[model samples]
Target: MIEHATHQKIALITGANKGIGRAAAEQLAALGMTVLIGARDPRRGEEAAAALRAAGGNAHQVTLDVTDQATARAAAQQIDERFGHLDVLINNAGITGSGQVSPEDAHDQVPSSVNLDMVRAVFETNVFGVIAVTNAMLPLLRRSPAPRIVNVSSAAGSLTIASDPDGPLTGLPTSAAYTPSKTALNALTVQYANELRKNGFLVNAADPGYVDTEINNHSGYLTVAQGAAALVRLATLGADGPTGGFFSEDGPVPW
Candidate 1:
């Protein structure tokens, strides 16, 4: 355990080596919080953290593979030993089982053809992983006066949007794997928020707005910063901020 001042807020973001996660980390660090770049690869995590430091931010690297319980526990332990408490936890690590989120790829993800193993793998990272990391970090988060947990979800997870005949989501293919995992994540976000609300822990889901990340094969229209905006906002929410809700930069998103 390393000794540090208790006044400083500490944040840990998973899958932060690149894309929206990295962007969110940089933005949060700019706000004066110590940001931990949690990545599955130690080298990449350290590289990202180094880049943040070079840019004048209080940043560090933590090797964290969200799907692995041991790594999640180790990350929590590291934070506990060094920061003593966690002010923010952003569950940004996720995957689209389909290689590319293209219209062609969408056809392969339809219920009948989608591989059950692929769906399980997607849920392992997006859903179960969130549970593992959040549970491991809860004790540290509870130490904060105003703890925040932001789960990075997607508009594709919204049942309202998916069910609408004239909605934007209606054009997309039915995704049995990626989409459902995010929907489950949204449910988890609400459950956690409801349970932790009395304790002043704000848990919410963030829709990153179809960013041009590797997950989408850089085909998305939004920029990384644009996608990260809602995430940073949720992570830095005040005590009076809404919890157990889904939101995007435009405002509240449907459940």
Candidate 2:
């Protein structure tokens, strides 16, 4: 039987019911960490955890909603009561805020005419949600010997890439919601890393590199497993791993 002991490192991944988040949880579980599959939907969360358990991984479900402070706090409380500490926190929950906009149409996200509500909604999840969940779990994470936090960001959020005339996004319509939310997330990652570095926390942002998932209607070239590699790598980093930085599967990503 797989052991669910306090001696084992515990990882809590937000929105871990599916997509990159679920993929990260699976990878972490394979690495011998007690994985907590955090999902807003309890049913989905339990299904994911059961699947992992059936695969010989130690996994549990945590009813969590990044946007809801009550659920976030409740998840933290539940973790504290069960395991007493959390070794890793992967803030993988995010949204493109592209409701009804087809993947082909970038016009809805264009700066000038973009809906303000969409922008706010995107920030609420992609940016503010991270803060809510992280803060809620900070106490439990503090008790760990080594703590790690990985914020799933995107290449579109990279200012350097977006600003380059010859970059991949040169001719793409200017994004006002999804892209900006990721940028803000990256910035938040840095600030958190700075604040917690002295306390032995490794906080970094990861660019999953256009994985085929619900966010883009499966238009991405990469698979979920391929995209989750960066997050898993960062989450399992050694003591000397770089903090307050952005990375992809290949290497460092410029800010």
Per-residue lDDT tens digits for candidate 2, residues 81-156, read 8888899999999988777344444348888888887788889899999999999999989988889999999999
Query: TM-scores of all models?
Result: 0.95, 0.95
Give the least accurate 10-residue stretch of model 2, judged by summed lDDT.
98-107
Model 2 ranges with Cα > 4 A deviation: 1-6, 100-107
| Model 2 lDDT, full chain set | 0.92
Which candidate ranks first by TM-score, i.e. highest?
1
List the lowest-lDDT window of 10 residues for candidate 1: 98-107
- Candidate 1's residue-wise lDDT over 77-181, tens digit each? 989898889999999999888753344454378998787777888999999999999999999999888899999999999999988999998777788999999
Candidate 1 total steric clashes: 0
List the global CA lDDT of all models.
0.92, 0.92
